[model samples]
Target: MSETLSGQATSTISAVVGRADVLIVGGGLSGAMLAAQLLRLPGRRRILIVEPRAELGRGEAYSATELGHTLNGNAARMSVDPDNADDLTQWLEAFIAKGGWPESDQQHVPVSELFPPRGIFGLYVQQRLAEAREQGAVSGSTAEHVCGEAVDLHIDSSGARLTLADGQCLEGAYAVLATGMFPAARTRQKHSSGLNAAAIDPWDVAAMSRLDPQGTVLIIGSGLTMVDAVVSLEQAGHRGPIRVFSRHGLLPHVRRQPPAWEDFLAADQSIRSPRQLLREVRRQCAAALASGIDWQAPLDTVRAHIGRLWSQASDVQRRQFVRHVRPWWESHHHRSPPLSAELVERLYKEGRLTIEAASLKGLDEPRDGRVSISIRPRGESRARTVTGEALINSTGIEYDWRRVDRPLPQQLLARGLIRPGPLALGIAADPGGAVVDAEGDVSTRLFAMGPPLRGMWWESTAVTDVASQAKALAVRLAQLMDSQKGRG
Candidate 1:
């Protein structure tokens, strides 16, 4: 083992600890894609990925064991490679040609347009990682997967020291935080007297299965997560009336294969505020509709420029946007797959599903194994009660790091190693994904990517954005490593 000091910091050396040139803290899609991209670089570097799960590349979103859960986007747009946008489509073609997937499961959609199950996508990611590893082996680069959870990180001038849940320590010259989506934080109950056990996790299919099949079910939030919950119930032979409640009661619109439109905002430097941007977008949508084109085409054009617009907006403008326009924007922009939307519509038409615009008041603890919920309907002064056999919280991923209950985040915050990003949405990081420390210094040895970058880029969670970030970060890290090697 060797140790070197840079500036005021000194790195301790321990010969027994595992070591790698680059260490990734999460083995989800973000970390796996980064590792894959790094392996393609022309250097022989040791890479270590620390993930508690037995499988890599399948995080909370894509690791769904339920068949009803599917990708929100089509195959053509979900490629892990930014340059090769149709790579997933090509992969799906090959997958379908092999005839291993059931014909009925295809849902009669074209291979390029199919929204495959999340589990299948997870497998594709794993396969890509494996291929990258094999290719790296021929070039002398090596990648190792460590099945462990990274609990804490200690950094010095030379590098970082990562402590795992299993009492193992790993040393690396560089560390990347690729931890993906966090679980939804518990909603603040108005009255906490007896509502402790009244809530159920939206993703817990097993808990959902235990509910009375014919009893009423209450789902909070009418987004994609709530759609997933409803699908799970349907797949489990549930015939109950489902009630979905949200502030806007806005369900995600169905995705369409719209033709590409001219990106008017791409060259417009004057659009900074949310109101200006929204106005321009509406005008473009109106023009597109007049021309017999889908409004989604113009929306897609706007989506391409969201990051730039967001970065240019002032903090106050951003807050205003979040408060006044985020809900409508999210519902229209981040849409559900066609099949999922069809399922939801069919259920609503059959009177099995009801969407309500309301604010949850509180839950009156379980009574006779059922819970009574208080809700105030939109434009109403009086609150009404609804009883359900089960209540599922589908409010979506928690963005505030301060509210996250994870040990790693808690430790990082307590030690002043990291600070919350804009609006406390996620961790603060530069555009290159290098994490900014509490002292406001950007760390060369520490970096981050994926969902943690939501504060930096509003569109960071999708596969396209993530894959592009991973590729760019990999190139940056590889160049940095090469420079250090030359100095050594």
Candidate 2:
């Protein structure tokens, strides 16, 4: 009895109806996009997409209530079209034509500009997905969307069966897992003291809504999440000081204006280990700066070929980079909106914002209802305590599911269907994103995409990267299903 958002259970009629040609387990951006691509194919096929969320397109990344939450990339670079480079721009134009935005805000902005409102992109994705669903209806193939969590997967020589949480079962020739980012649980470290309430996980809307207007908020990490926290606080009328603490104490750089375009790093040159790739990025960043342009030009170059770059890396090199270099790489590669960064810098200069290089040591709850945090600086042995009216974790989403310490993963691990990646970095998978089983062999039908496969591919988080992977995976599935049908 799998259930939809309405809590209406779906009976075990799928098997009787015949298995879906493809069953997608997570209906976030990747899963939704993949479904759209499959429906666009020129053949009749039954597809079922299983997602627990009531909302479809937003998922974890794009779902945001605040207007301040914008996309990390600009509209031009965020297009869904693999063919038309200006797809997002065209999409925006069409949206504006439909009277979707204010005329004053309709200035021509380059796609390379880092747009900060993720809700806008979420709306775009929803519109596109809805259109695709209509297209699917017109075609011979039919798509059924199930609102339920896929709790278990059983696979044999014939096909794969998915067991939903409510006990409804769905059998499909193929399935793809697109579980997005899951944030790490707050630690009991000293630095987190007085910060428990301040810790605002990205997914917690209730927590964010409880923020006090005049409270001094301490953010745990400095990244895109921190950027989001800052913007959200401002929107929430937080006038007090906001502090961001992290190991590197480095915030993401802002996108430069008049977007610099350099095709220096060819797509083929992207194939290399993480170390080699980091060196290439460094060289390119330096070259861009030397040539009197901002460092973002090189990053844009890298994003164009990130999938190939990750696919080519050896597993050992991939692990090494995740451990030693991921934090720094993330700050530079996933940047913030220029205006937002400027606001943060202004807050810093005005003494309303402070970024500290330290690890959280403790969190103390005050009787008066405030939290106190203890932090030990990177080098000094001495610890310091800072009291904030509020503490927002803003540490960003954690990909390492092992840290989630959830029952489902534990159960799956025992069943030998899935394994944690190197150091529990992310869900383990092969280059093509087929989940590695407990016995260390790649499962044939169980596939995963998006941030869940971060361990397998170091650069798998962003929408552009994930969309490309989803499209490629759709092609593979189409080919695989076609071959199977031919055999039958």
Tens digits of per-residue lDDT, candidate 2, 377-443, equal 8898998888777777766656656555444455577688888875576788887788898789888
RMSD of each: 5.0, 3.7
- Tell me each candidate's TM-score: 0.93, 0.88
lDDT for each residue of candidate 1 in 267-354, tens digit (9 for 90 to 100): 7878888999889889999999999999999898787788877776778988988988899888999899887788899999999999
- The local lDDT score (0 to 100) that residue 177 gets in candidate 2 is 80
Best by TM-score, which number?
Answer: 1
RMSD of candidate 1 to true structure, Å: 5.0
lDDT, residue 336, model 1 = 91
Task: Estimate the overall C-alpha local distance difference test score of candidate 1.
Answer: 0.83
